[model samples]
Every structure is written in structure tokens, then in C-alpha cells.
Target: MPTAAPLAPAATAAARAYLPALTGIRAVAAYMVCLHHFNPFAEGPGLGGFLHNLLLEFHVGVPVFFVLSGFLICLRYYGTEQWTGRWWGRYLRNRVARIYPMFLLLTTLTFAPAWLAHAPDTTRLWLLNVTFLRGFFDAHKYSGIPQGWTLTVEECFYLWAPVAFGLLRRRPRLLWLQPLGLLALGCALVLGLGPLAYEGLFGSFRFMLLYTFFGRAVEFYAGMQLALWYRRGLLRAPRGPRGLYTAAGLGLLLAAVLALVAVRGQYPYGQEAPAGIALNNVALPAGIVLLFAGLLTEATWLRALLASAPLQLLGRSSYVFYLIHFGTIKGWLRDYVTASPAGQFVLLNVLAIGLYYLVEQPLNRLLRAPSAAEPAN
Candidate 1:
């Protein structure tokens, strides 16, 4: 079977051993981001009612992707990491094959129109976006693909995780230092670079805190910690309630959403507030880990729903869905395919699924195929 879109980056691998529910959750996360953009369910401008506010908070799905990345990466590659040149090459190639090709295609498509139209030279913008260097620049982060910025953070984590796992193997006591050090580095970057304002590189405390890996390292770490616990059999399901973790995870998730709504004073998102940042970066990730633990262990109906074959297919296609859900293709879908919002949504999913199977899967397999010097996993 084709490996699903790279979830670590916006998708994850069920390649080593597939988890049906987590695969389904990828569809859920991607769609949540889609709905945050489409927002047809909500009835308001900014945030009208409680339902609207809650839906607005669907942007939290970004953290869901982040957490899934951490969990799946550790689950698959934890003890397998090696310093051998071939092993490292295969690992990095697997990651690149999973994410980069389709991004390259769509990013070029996004800029091609502007270039053809001769609407201000955007060659630099194209370069930054194609390389994902734009993600660090506040001014350019949304220049090509708006949602692609998260990939920068995911890529950072991807590069660091193997080294981190190696270090943790040597000194298990230092696990807590990873995120703390990242947070400190984030602060340092803001203080050192914010005033200089070099193309908004680490421009503001808020941007660094919210957008970059430095600020949101906690989310990924929570997932890694959960995966480690799961691997060690440390996360035991409760005996009494049968659905205790599921219930608790759901409750915490709801509470975090509500808390964000409550603290969203004047700002567009609650995450802008310091308290809101804490809730999203710390509280929300904790909730997601609990939720994932429930999905992994508990035999809840929700898990059954998530693990269903159809949902799994959607999950498999979800990375393409995420990458094209916004920016250029979305506009193209609206213009050429269907102007109606619901129609556009249906068509969007159809196109994403098609691209995943037709374009992405074949290329991924080709890139990941073993060479003369390297062995396949």
C-alpha cells in the first residue's frame, strides 16, 4: 500500500506499523484546518457565537499535526536511528520523499501565475517559499502557501529528533532539557534579532512564540514523551470507567478550546494572549497526548469510527489535502471547478485524493526505492 502523506511534516508514517485510528486522525486534523478556512459551519465575522468561537479554534489542528509527527517519528524510528552514512541517508531521504516533491509542485504552481502575469518580480518570494526559508521570515511566511509555514517547524524537528534520541539514550535524565533549552533559545532569538528586523527573522516575541519550532517545541515533545511511555508500557488504561482516558482527553480538549475563547480579548485568537499561549502550547498538547493514548489503547466507539477504512483513506490523502487546501489551488478550484463553498470542498477533497494516489504515491515510492549501495527497510 502507498505510504500516507508525511504527517510529521503535516502527515506521518504508518509505514513501519500502521495505526488505523491515528491515520484517521490525520484526516481529521487536515479537515479541521480546512474548516477553519472554509468556516461555513460557523455563523459570524470574527467570532459570533460559542459555536463560532469553538470552530475558530480549529486552527489548533496545527498542534494536532505536530503532536502526531512526534509520536509517529519516535514510534517508528526511536531505537533504529544510526550514525552510519547509509542509514542516515535513507532516513533523511524517506522524510524528503514523504513531503518535498508535492510541495515543490504546488509552490511552483502558485507562483507561476504571478510570474506569467508580470505582477511585480516575486522571484525572491518563490525562492524562499520553495526552500521553506520563508517560514522564518514573518513578512514572507504566507507569500506562497499560507499553511506551508508549519512545515518549517516540522522540518526543524525532523532534523533534531535523531540527534535528540541518541542523546537521550546516553543520558535519560536530560529529557526535560530539550524543550526548556528551545524556549530559552526562542527568547534569545527574539531579543537578539527582533530589533534588527532582518526581513522579520525572529521578528517579534509573539511570532517566535507562536509560529516557530522554538515556541511550539512543547507540543512535539509531549507527543515524543507519550510515544516513549507507550513504547515502555507506562501509559496504562484505567480499569473503572472503560472510557476514562477518552472521556478525560475529550474534556481537556474542550476545556482548552473554551479557555482560548474566554481569553481572546481584542486579539483574533486566544493564542495571542500569554495565558492563551500557555494553554495552547502546554495545555492543548497535553490534552492531545491523552487523546492519542486513548485512541491507541481504549476500545472506544470513537476510535472505531476513526479507524474505519473510509476515514483511513481520507487520512492517507490528507497531506495533499492540507497542502492544497489553501492558497492557489483553492482559488483555482473556486474559479474553475465550482464557486459554491460546499461544492468547492467536495471537489477539493476529490482533487487531493486524486493527486495523492496518482502523483504523490508513485513519486514517493520511486524516491524511496533502494539503490545499489543502500538496503530497503
Candidate 2:
């Protein structure tokens, strides 16, 4: 009935800045994962089980985050190539400043006391987590923050993204080659190291397909392609209706998730199976790219809601919340404050905000001070 709001400058500007609605989407993704882990819905064979299983598939949040990372990284740094030592230093410094400091602090805090008391075993696990090598081993991936496994996938992408962009610059049609090669490498690892059966090294096909960056690189590539089109000003909105793309994106995402729920037969979730893997690793990311493109170009109510001040703050602090949602901090919350799911969600968000301002922000600033605290790229 009324006119839609204008899009944010970050959405369409040539200058690279963070999009507010996308930041809000970060909040949604982190919270979806938290809910997936701490779901309170009743589990039964009928409608109740269906509802619970639907929530379980909220693991799709990880894909949303992956796609966002790819989009933002490419959007911000795609063509800003210097390729010199100083530029590489600055770029890596920025990425490290953004992620590593808080992750290191929290990860150490997670394992320190246990390491002190139980030096040998805990020390090795602590080393694995701190180095992020734990993510490569299925037996150890859940040792520390649990969700920290995603960081491994992220770091791999970070190291490889520039190379990918450079290759795409030369061989545009071979864009899919990067992810395909990664998939082949993963299969090799499974066939080679999997035979060893040594501590779940290289892991099962399910682990390789579902968890590793090699298999999940398609999601990032999807985001990268979206960024390329968007930066070229090709991601135009329709003349009248504002939310059609948003609605379609939501429909596609829901259809994928519901399909995953439907096919969970004989496995914990549908993604453990071959068909489920294709849907999650590919189809789900397609929905996310559409959703993000809509958010970037249109001024729908969804965009306005995501751009609101509170959601912005929540989105800013969402990384902290994602890290703390299920592990040690949640335990403390359950022990000290409230045992209820809803209550803990609220309390955890409050704490995450506090940590963002008090801890992550300060460390990020200090680390990036040598180079102005911006992205190295």
C-alpha cells in the first residue's frame, strides 16, 4: 500500500561497505543454529516429530554463513588486487584481526583449565583446536567450541579465495574447477587416509561431504558468482513488487529444508544420504544467493526489519553468540541463570552483545591498528 524504503548505500554503492540487512541475516543464521542445538520441541512419530526434525535441519544456517562469507569477501576485495607483499600482509592481517583473536581467546579459555589438570590428553586436544587441525579429524572436530569446525572451512576459503579470484580472472568458464578439484581431493583423502582408520583421520564420506570445505566449496562459489553479478549492476529489482524475490527465496529455502526433513529415514538427518547431500550442498545455497541478492537490491519489509537498529546490534554481536551458543558458556548459563530454552536465548544474546563491545571489538581494533584495522585486501 505504501512506498518501500530506499536501499542502503552499502547494498548498491561502488564503495565496499558492509550491508546492514546482511548483518541482520548473520543474527538469524547464528540463532537458527543455536535453536537447532537447543531445540525444545517434543519428539514423536507424528506431527511433533516432523516439527522437531524441521528444526533439526536448521543446520542450513551454516550454509547461509558460508555463502555470506563468500559474497562479502568477493564484494569487498574482488578487484582490489595489489598482489604485493605489503598487500598480502595487510589482507591476511585484516582477516586474522577479524576472526582469530576472539577465536583464540575463547578457544584457550575453553581448554586451559582442563589442560592444567589433565596436561597430556587435554594439551593435545587443545593444540588441535587452537591450530584448527582438529576439524580435519572427525573424532576431534567437536572437541572445543564444537561449532568451531566452521571456522576451519572459513579459514580454508580465506586462504584460497584470492587464488580462486585470480584463476577466475584468467579462466572465467573454469570457475567450477576450483570446487571440483577440491571435491576430487577430498575423495582421494577418503580413499587413501580413510583406509588407515587411524583416529577418524580424513573421515568417512559423510564427514568429507557434509563437513569439509572441499565438499562445501560450492556454496562459497555460489556466493562469489552472486557478488560478480551484483557488482556489475545486473542484480536489478522488478519495477513494482518489492518482496517477490524475497518470497521466492524463502520458498526455495523452506522447500529444501522440508525435503531434508522428509528424507531423514534411517539416518540422523537427510544430509547423511547422497540425495540429501546434493540438496543441502547445492540447492540450499542457491536459495541463499537469491535471498541475499533480493536483500541487496530491494527495499522490502524484510530488509527494513533486518536493517533496524536492534537487529543491527544483534547481527554485530552474532559471531560471539554463535561461538558460545552450545558449549561452556551455555553450561554456565544453565547452571547460574536459567534452564529454559527461551530464557537462555535471551540471556545469551545479551552476553554476546557485551562480549562484542568489551572483548572482540577492542582486540580487533588493536590487531588492525598497525594497518588501520581494515581488511588487508
Q: Residue-wise lDDT of candidate 2 within 1-377, one digit each (tens)?
A: 12223334654464255578988999999988986887768799988877888998899999999999998888776665456777678778888889888899889888876877876688788889888888889999899899999999999899888878777777888988889999999999999999899788886988988888988999999999898888777888866666777878999999999999888788887877788999999999999998998898888899999999999999999999999998988888899999887899899899999999999989888877384423321
For candidate 1, give the lDDT.
0.84
> Clashes in model 2: which pairs?
90-376, 91-376, 368-373
Span of 10 residues, lowest total lDDT, candidate 1? 1-10
**What's the C-alpha lDDT at position 353 in model 2?**
97
Off by over 4 Å in 2: 1-15, 45-47, 369-377
State the C-alpha lDDT per candidate: 0.84, 0.85
Q: Write the per-residue lDDT of candidate 1 for residues 272-374, one digit (tens) a residue.
A: 8889999989999989998999998899998999899899788889999999989899998888878998887788889988998999989888887374122
Top candidate on lDDT is 2
Estimated TM-score per prediction?
Answer: 0.92, 0.93
Residue 46 in model 2: shift from native, Å? 5.3
Which runs in model 1 stand beyond 4 Å of their true positions? 1-15, 41-48, 369-377
